[model samples]
Target: MPRLLIAEDDADLGPAMKRALELDGYVVDLFARGDDVLVAVGVGSYDVILLDIGLPHMTGLEVLRALRARRDETPVIVITAFDRTPHRVAGLDAGADDYVVKPVDLEELAARIRSQLRRRERRHDDSLSVGRVTLDFAGHVASMDGEEVLLTAKEFRVLALLMRRSRRFVSKTDLEGELYDQDQWVESNTIEVAISSLRRKFGRDFIRTARGLGYMVGGLEA
Candidate 1:
């Protein structure tokens, strides 16, 4: 299930939005403060973020700017009561993937989320290969040394992220967000388990660890 983080300050509207999105099958988290929204994004994984402009402590626009400043590409949709041209332009210019004016239609919100997710999926849809191991994402299959390899669902997701990012390090927190939903009870060592399993199948050098930082695809010997 897709996870969503909603930062809305209105007492009544926040809860109403949460319940509505939950009913649409999204695992939702609500934050009434803008700073809290930033904190949640740093520690939690969410497929899409709904940010309301009128937030306490910090405006949603400020929050969006901070997120983009860090190069975080998570899709964000700005939700606000301001439907004026300047507000819409400012939100888009500040890195919001989409914007919605208030009195939000839940159905429309859901559709927009789906569209962003689809676009994200397309970004990483290509088949990938490193050394003798090859991953066919379209077919949902993998092969190493000319033989088929079977991987658990979680394993595939880990491999896919690593492959797509290649040399770039993917932090544990980021990987966790992508691999599991917020509502799921995940063990602390869940990511470690997946990494260990991948190494066992593809060899240790297939993934390199940066001590306290994260994991990345290292140069695989041909």
Candidate 2:
């Protein structure tokens, strides 16, 4: 599942958007203040951010500028009631990847999110190859040694993250965040179970574990 952050101060609209996006198969974290958004982005990773311009404590443009100053390239779509030309220009100039006016159409918002994702993915190859294993992100398929490997949705997501960060350990906590949303109930051994299942299909040594550091792929010895 893709992770998203929503910064909207409207008490009702915030939750409504969160729920709707969640229904669209995204793990969403909602914040009502710009300061809180900064805090969240500092510690958590998100594929996209939906920002409201008039947020409390700090304006969305301020947050956007701060992120750009630090070179945080995560895609952001500014959402505000002000649809004036200057407002839109200011947002684009501040490094917003896209902009949307208030009273957003849910379907259009979803499409915009997808577009951002596709654009980001294009920054890298459509597929990843590590040893004999290959993951075709565009086709949503995995294969090993020219043979197709079956994977459930959760399993595929877990594998994608690990393969993308190949040669680097991905902590279990990070995997959990990628696999499930806050509202979902996750088993203590959910990651372990998935890892074990993947090893069964891909070969026992395909993935390696680092006691406290977590798991990784592309560590196969020659």
Candidate 3:
């Protein structure tokens, strides 16, 4: 999991922000002062930063500019008390991703964090390796046991989605949505056929059936 730095100067809001992000599965580091944030940012590899524009020593804008000057690409969402037009624009210009005004909903803040992390995930697809199975999306290949297991396009798409979100049970409907036209008349068991095909081409144990729940695709260790 990626870490988040919550740099809020307000005494009450800072701990609240920390609790919200921590509940959402992020390892959070809190800094009540802007000067403290400068030291915190250098100490850790933060995936996203929630910065308050109004601060004691360094304003959020100055910190953002300083970070960008050092070529830091960590996504910074300016969580500011300032609702002025110039503040928002200046934050964006200073390399902030989005600006959230004060008195914000923690759920929406968490959603924004998730959106940024997902964008970063898609940007870097070095490869998805699970146990002995590997899904090379760019090369359009699935290899196991040091050999290419020839797969159809639909098989690849189904496998890719599962591999991307491996360890979770992907429902039949979700996989169907990924494989076919939404408006088209496809059989209810179309996904079953695809799953069966993938299992045959790869290995019988490649994807596990969860009875009525859905399909679990990947090794247990993966």
Best by TM-score: 1
Q: Would you list the C-alpha lDDT of every candidate in the order shown?
A: 0.84, 0.87, 0.79
**CA lDDT for candidate 2:** 0.87
Which lDDT tens digits does candidate 3 get at residues 70-167?
Answer: 55567899998789899888999999998899897898999899988887677537556555778777888889866888887877788887776554
Q: Which candidate tops lDDT?
A: 2
Clashing pairs in 1: none
| Greater-TM-score candidate between 1 and 2 | 1
Instruction: Give the worst 10-residue stretch by lDDT in candidate 2.
Output: 213-222
Residues 56-173, candidate 2, lDDT per residue (tens digit)?
9999999999877655667999999999999999999999999999898889999999999998778546876667888888888999988999998888889988877665689999
Q: Score residue 122 of candidate 3 by CA lDDT.
A: 73
- Model 2, which residues run further than 4 Å from truth? 126-169, 172-222
Model 1 Cα shift for residue 72 (angstroms): 0.6
- TM-score for all predictions? 0.62, 0.61, 0.56
2 or 3, greater by TM-score: 2
Q: Give per-residue CA lDDT, model 1, range 50-131, as digits (tens).
A: 9999999999999999887755667899999998999999999999999998899888988999999898777557666655
Error of 3 at 149 (Å): 32
**Which 10-residue window in model 1 sums to the lowest lDDT?**
213-222
Worst lDDT run of 10 residues, candidate 3, spans 213-222
